[model samples]
Target: MIHSLDPAPSAQAAMLDGATPLTQLGVIRVEGEDAAAFLHGQLTQDFSLLGLSEARLAAFCSAKGRMLASFVGFKRAHDDILLVCNRDLLAPTLKRLSMFVLRAKARLSDASENFQVFGLAGGGVPAALPTAVWSQWRDGQVSVVRLPAAPGAVRALWVAPVGAAAPTATALAEPLWQWLEVQSGVAMLSQPVVESFVPQMLNYESVGGVNFKKGCYPGQEVVARSQFRGTLKRRAYVVHAEGALVAGQDVFSEGDPDQPCGTVVEVAPHPVQGFDAIVSLQTSAAAAGGLRAGSVSGPHLTLLPLPYSLLEDI
Candidate 1:
């Protein structure tokens, strides 16, 4: 459904070409015999489903079932799995993952700089991928087709080895990626916000980030409870703030100073307008509308519909 936005080959290539590789993003490689087995039991998604040409979105959580980080997980080879997350969480996350691989036949290493990550908006990909890939699409083929975040904002990826030549495209800055994240409703986990959310609170299941049927992970119990128990008090939603927003900032309802009704998950300057953010809040506070942080008179926030829907049952 996604086609190349450029009518001209040169224009398209120019949009694709760049001195600083526009397609390549920071990456980390986790390789070892036990890589898949180890990750299968540690992440929110099913690692057994990963393939050389496929990708997934998964979460790292604390043993108590609190979300520590979220990532675009994919496989480069039978032994290599890639975890793409926020730059700020790289070192610590890598260190943490490495800690658990002591005896397992797995090796975790940071590969952020070795590969380039690009966002190809619109459809120009060949038909070798999923017709509807809602999450990360890690491909290395020429003119590869990738799934988009949404129908309106079709995005593909073109990743290559370091020093790889680009296809000659305008080098849009990284902010564009962040903008897409906000608009697409992809809530990323950041440093101060680690261990703050369970997968359900962020709509991870609907987005293909959580696999309920999968064996088990750190926060499996709590996450399962939040879903099957029908006791989910919090859910992530798109929101906007009049003032600068920070992740982990408390969100209040009716200006009440009680247990924060919610917390900011992700925020970014709108590409063409005001600011945009994702907030996870208690379902009760969400129905009432008006929510603020520091003070009722301070920053007022407006709620926006998420790109995807939360399943009714769970």
Candidate 2:
């Protein structure tokens, strides 16, 4: 079992903690002669220039620009790419992606059964892996990608063939890993909230999930308009709330309880508090007053500091 590195608090402590099985995530593999060329025309990132040593945070959007799914994608080989996303959306996401492959030589498959994903935090790499965010290294059939971590902490995603040798290092508890994921402020895409927000609404552009200069994809025009027009009125923010907060849950401002001011994009149980969540809401509402989840008398939410700056003026 994994253990904590320091006896501090919960959310922060988890980042400096050990490893855990990322059972909540799933993987999709796209391989063939046209993999790179095909994905370049679909996702929001510049996959054509994605080097073997690097990974990207990308979003697959609908024609209307709403994000269908978000992924931490990396190339396994010159013609192979792996996309990691929430398990619940894998099957449908794969199916939808396949439909667009029409004549491309690329093939999409649910590689979840063939691979086991794990999250490692506050620990040293396996000697064969790199320690920088988005950098990748390989050990046999297992590929490890250094992922963005909380401030002053280290984290990585380990993906290996199901039957391959598992990392012998101790792991952090799964709950702790989930909590840290929310605390990091990178909202995760789940089935309940699919096709909800545009990439910018989730702060994707600021976090390297969107490449504005890249060629067109599904909702390229809409995404471009939002950025260049400066008409985006909503953004994702970090908040702490009492009671259970879940993805797709509504957030309302006390000033106007009749209408929802935001939606809970991602949430997790906090070690010291009831729950921590990344909420996407109107900027004005977030700045006005404290938000409540569920109803007017529902649990009140307090906005917390986001680890990164938003691209509001862009």
The best candidate by lDDT is 2
Stretch of 10 with least lDDT, candidate 2: 1-10
Error of 2 at 43 (Å): 0.3
Candidate 1: tens digits of C-alpha lDDT, residues 53-114: 67778899998888887877777778887777778888877888777776899888877777
lDDT of 2 by residue, 97-201 (tens): 999999999989999988899887776346566766678887767788887666545678889888987777676778777776776778879987898899988
* True-structure lDDT of candidate 1: 0.70
Q: Relative to the unseen true structure, what is the C-alpha lDDT of residue 173 in candidate 2, on a scale of 0 to 100? A: 73
lDDT (CA) for every model shown?
Answer: 0.70, 0.83
Instruction: Superpose all Cα atoms of candidate 1 onto the true structure and report the RMSD in Å to 1 decimal.
Output: 5.1
Looking at candidate 1, the ten consecutive residues that score lowest on lDDT are 16-25
Candidate 2 positional error at 180, Å: 0.9
Name model 2 segments beyond 4 Å from true: 1-15, 124-131, 312-314
Candidate 1 — which residues are off by over 4 angstroms?
1-25, 123-129, 134-151
> How does each model score on TM-score?
0.84, 0.92
